[model samples]
Target: MRLIAGATAALSAALTAVLLVPQPASAATQLIGNGAFTSSTTPWAAIGQTTVTAESGWMKVAVKQVVANPWDAMVAAPTTAALNPGKSYTLSFDAYSTTAFKARATVQYTATPSANQLLATDVQLTTESKRYSIPFTAATATDTAAEVTFQLGGSGGAPTVRFDNVSLLETQTTRPTALYVSPLSNPARWAGDPANDGDTAKAIAADIANEPIFEWFGGWFGDITKAVDDYVGAAQAQDKLPMLVAYNIPNRDACGGQSGGGAGDATGYHNWITEFAKAIGTRHAIVVLEPDAVAAAECVTKFGKDPEDQYRMLLDATQVLRAQAPNAWVYLDAANATWHAPDKMAPLLVKSGIANTRGFSVNVSNYFTTVDSETYSVAVNGYLSGTVGTKKYVIDTSRNGNGPYEDDTPGDNWCNPPGRKLGTPPIRQLSGAEYLFWVKVPGDSDGQCGISDEPAGTFDPDLAMALING
Candidate 1:
């Protein structure tokens, strides 16, 4: 029941949803030699009155507009080392101003470096210290070194800026061994809210600790961009790459008797995808686009909307995502091993921008074995052997470890398959697979498997234990 004035309730709900999900922390890679200023600023270039002794553990600068230096007032430093291209990097540091100084920091790149990009802005910094972070994707093919320039002083007058605990790190995002559980498909608030209780946290603690989690998207209504923005922020906070499932195809998950709904119509989906793309922005992500959108088109192939039409939709969606979030990688859903023939699926994938995406995923919500999925994927890859680019696929190892339940028919028992074990947790470069991800949250009931009375996507303890324990 919708409350009459539910803004307060809505806000509370939004806050609660974000809180249950914990962020994952990542390791840092250093590039600056004397970033901390422990020793004299040898590797770091300083002009005018920039010295290490001015502050306890920082480089204090009191510089003016000088001869050919051309900077308003700042201290600049170039990396004594080179940087790897095609990787995005972030630099963070603590800054304090003796007075009200508008501070800005610029980072420079290329083998022969000069000032190019500005990171931090001219905010009025007071005596109190504040942390500032800046990230840049190295698109330059020949960037050999990196440099940072800081404007410590205000434009109004000569400024004094001090920096400490400086760190530069590559945005270390690899495929998940088990990415931090994300709140995609509106999972039980934390990872996948299959249990629908606060106590699920008490239960998930043991396995989830090191279980690199991934998130899903594409099920919400209204402004989903806000949710994506929130989820991405949370993932970044934990240093995990947020993986999303773009499931809101115009008509998705048809004969499977699952959540077979989209935003509204085909036009409706286009609008939704537009916002979805904008929300992701330039943050790094791994997206599994439109699960079952292409594979299940036979269920909705009526009137004018044929399988080819669905293919067009998926192709357009990938283009939108690529144009909007350049760093984010896309993976189309290739259905499961049992669903489609490799030849049928391969051509569809190539048509739906497979070359543009990282790859496709399989067995997203089924009890299929990883070995079988890999075998099927290899056959499909063979079909498009020379056509697809880089050509790899991810498997839904979320629930395939002990293997599938003995089904009467190969088509039967995808929902809440009994005795299925949690498969391999998300791992990077898992030989045949790109990443073995928890695409389907383990504990959530799959459309009310007869044994359990819980709603779809809610936690089921019996199912959870079978998968978790195995």
Candidate 2:
């Protein structure tokens, strides 16, 4: 009996040493070997009608022709190890092509019947270089040899594609710190309104008054500094982090919609953004910088304005905020999932200086399910991961509880669609995003739409009541 016990103990000790001792503990670890292609493309190879070569620091793939299917011309490399079943992984790479085209990327079995894919998604490649991230859970059986592939065919013509910094890492989930629940939010003010009496006011107080929400600042506020400082001060006194929005970019809301005014020009915008950041000073704050600035840059062309000007202004704004408010976390707005695909928006984000800010925010002033917003944000991160490094993102869950409103008039879907409900209240450390914020205050009218006649930003109690009840 003693000999048998000793033998069993020795085997268990050896297994533990092999499993835990040699591998250093880390939240995330790279799973792809030779992703940088610094020296050569040893493990990476050409597939179909593509030729792969390591030039300078990139894996350059020259496609001979546009084949019938995307996978007909491809470049593939094997992962270091089999992906764990049910484990989430993020595949990020920096890529560009000689011409703009759509390609496909996949993680699949390396051997015959490679059709057992873990993730398959479209990659939008443009002339300019950009990073992309694709987060997926390994659902299929673990295959010892799996390859990460980029399909370059089926674009109607052959375009040479270049890839660098190809990285596949196990995703690590993180939570955020407690967010500040502002005492001065519009709902709190309404709860104390003179005309409000019993049950109605009580519901507003209990349901919405105590929730965390953001305060927006713009040219409408005569004194930006004082307004910002006062709000930050109130939150600081309670030992809470304040949430703010700096929405005074030049040519703001270029669509010339209801919320279409901004500072006069570049110089005016610089001065305004500088003061806004200065007001936050050394305090801890979460600022969503310019809601629609980058996403709406394309509309500026119709007015004979260069989109580059908007990108430059935003770049400067990020730099100013970084230098001025060192402790503040600024999330550049990415509009929402419905507005732009990850490919189209990623380059814009890069051009707008996404690297200078903490990350980006999605679904501001619009209703999209948190799930859809998360998928878009993650895909955007895939594009950003290779360029500016992996970035954290936040989603605006102010009023998307019931998802988007589908009406006969599709154009007015975002304009205060009736029957919309309040989404998940403001919280931090949620999966998919760093935080779920009420960036757009609920109950605010979307410019004389749906059940309200008030202009945008005007607080309507009826709208507020309906949101709470929903």
Candidate 3:
């Protein structure tokens, strides 16, 4: 059957159809704190006459005692909330120590008395305020009877510690829709150069059916415009998302006269960021802005000069990209676990302007345990939420199962350290972040460059297999 319609009528119908279509979901998130305790009506009991104050989405617990150990108390969820079998959830809270004291906190999750219990124990505390997340997965269970308790302990004299902003949420189970590969298309190297016969991009798409997050090199001090265009065009043709990594740090690679090149100045770098944003405008892409930029700032400060200014430029670049690519997801590179604290960095990110930035990425290069990374992420996100009023973060779980074993062998051996494996399955939502992605391809070389170079990104078939199965 055929129906004929006039051009005006058809156009009117098309306009109506467009209006009916649902727009893409925005990435706005909500903050959940201790004040929203709905599972029980009983208020948290103070320990040993400790004073408590509720402020900024947290119940600040404080204590004063000179001689003996002082501890503050908080009630766990009163009712038992059973976790679905084989499902995971993240539990997080904020804690801070006012003085130097050996502090340890215990969070007990009451589960069915079974052989395998999902409980987190003996978490350490620091002088600075921080948040911690403990992830639990439930095994087969018949009845629902589970409760979680959080306890803080201090050693020696009474040192006051505050606790606040506790929350529990079901983690998302979906996999990531994109991936980012770094140093893949840099201009200087054989593997990074586009002209190479065995570039990682084609290999990834062909082997894994996953597109590579292309990181193109910019000019001496500016954005790499043409490289982005080429990669984006090729990616679109293959119906894949293009991922980018910005590495044009001033005096790049420390300008220590290493193989890494050096940029001219901050002004040049800022201009390059602007150019990069312009080139990537209005495209749906995933970007890892400045790998190790935040964590590796010390090197730039020592050698490249003006590390603080460079970080400011990086933040500015993030803002520019957000405005330029409204539909794109912009992620800040947390680089690894050793980088600055999330709370400390979040304020700087906001001060430099993060209203448009999507979220931050953790464990970019180093091999921090997934549990440890999650804890770090939760703390960072908590600080961000408290200060900037947002809850969002991303984690990199490329090769972190066994974590880097402590070795006194020395000499940058951690780069391609052996015996490391993959972690648990990647969760989409954890501690308010959107997703945990295997951003670094497991099989790719970490630029060990050669055997003498101390194996960077060394390929591990065993780890790769584990990741695939997970």
Candidate 4:
């Protein structure tokens, strides 16, 4: 017994050492903070004695006014990190307006002083403190210095802004190892609203299986559950994991405001989730828990009453579902890019026991562009990592082809807006997300709330084909 114990202990230690040692061939790359700005006060000494402030480990430079109009503050990386051509790297930072601001920022890498090439430029400003980043590949530039500069003058009356925590890092080696497809037809339909027709759920599942990762849909709705079961059985026959969405939102559709259905109370919601998880019974599926529930929390409160109990109910449902479906990867739905800031939402999610949950989903029902989606993803991811200390997410790439329609008219132009093309190809691994998925099927309308003419839950192949082509 002593000899056996000794051998086991020796094996465990050896395994630990092997895991800890960095691989020689793929030597772990060093992430150096070039102008990490941790130690620089008025780091833009050459340009001007611009007042730079550091708070909560973030460095901020505020440009009071660009007297000459082209004022810029630059921070450069110590060395230009070498990136293989075609390989992607993520450059990220936190930025916001001290007041309402209209300036733009650029991230550039240069080999020669005269030959600086811009990697990403003119990122627009937003009112909220946002995290922004872009993926870029290395060009032929051999310069050892990479610089981030802010062009802080806009329209003369634009607001002053601040930026901090600038970082550039190689994309993760192990990107999203999976992909999940939402099984339900649309938000209203999934919620058991009268708007759902329910024939296309199976088709959506089949289309999702064309990708390389896991596929799923909601199994909580009566019609949706039956379709998902058929799809799951078929996928099982072919040995594939079907993904699912749980939509039984209480006071769904905001009391006839927009999309609505499902459970009417806390007990009903929790019981439904529990029953749904059990009915699926060990099938390989990635379940997305409740679409638009968290994002629409405010609406729910406005339509009904206090949402504290409802949120608690969701927390209970999450725990029950996780416990029942231990073999399943369960996710929460993040409405879209614009609804909730990650930091604001992370605490709520964590308080609701999101740590036991798999991760969250984003860009569910908005037409934000891929770039904006990534920017939002980075901001949310930063909040999750920095505040909530979680690093898992999924992105919805359903109808973000042409970006958000450049109109802010107030109704729902974001829903099924026209002239949009498909954005980046859905990839497994991104900066902070676990997977990229088509949570919303393109053929279905975003309801008549927007400019789309098609009725809810109806398929428009022309729109679908345009998305495919775009």
TM-score of each: 0.61, 0.62, 0.50, 0.53
TM-score (C-alpha, index-matched) for candidate 4: 0.53
lDDT of 1 at 470: 70
Candidate 4, residue 413: how far the Cα is off, in Å: 1.6
* lDDT of residue 156 for candidate 4: 50
CA lDDT scores, all candidates in order: 0.64, 0.78, 0.51, 0.53
- Model 2 clash pairs are 131-383, 132-382, 132-383, 133-382, 133-383, 175-429, 176-429
lDDT of 4 by residue, 1-470 (tens): 00000000111221110112112222224344433456553433223324556555556655555443434433333334545544444455567765654555444564443355445456656666665544455555555455545556543543555666554555434322233232334432343334534454333333432433223333233544334444443433333445666666576545234455557677777776766665454445677777666655666667656667657777887788777666567787665565666667776676565677877777764566545555666666676786557657777766666556655453456555567665444565534466666666665665664445676445565455455555
Error of 1 at 84 (Å): 16
Encode model 1's per-residue lDDT on 227-274: one tens digit a residue. 565565456545667777777877666666556567667677777787
Tell me model 1's lDDT, rounded to 2 decimals.
0.64
Candidate 2 lDDT (Cα, 0 to 1): 0.78
- The window of 10 residues in a row where model 1 has the poorest summed lDDT is 1-10
Q: After best superposition, candidate 1 residue 74: deviation in angstroms?
A: 27
Measured on C-alpha atoms, candidate 4 has an lDDT of 0.53
Which residue runs of candidate 2 sit more than 4 Å off their true CA positions?
1-176
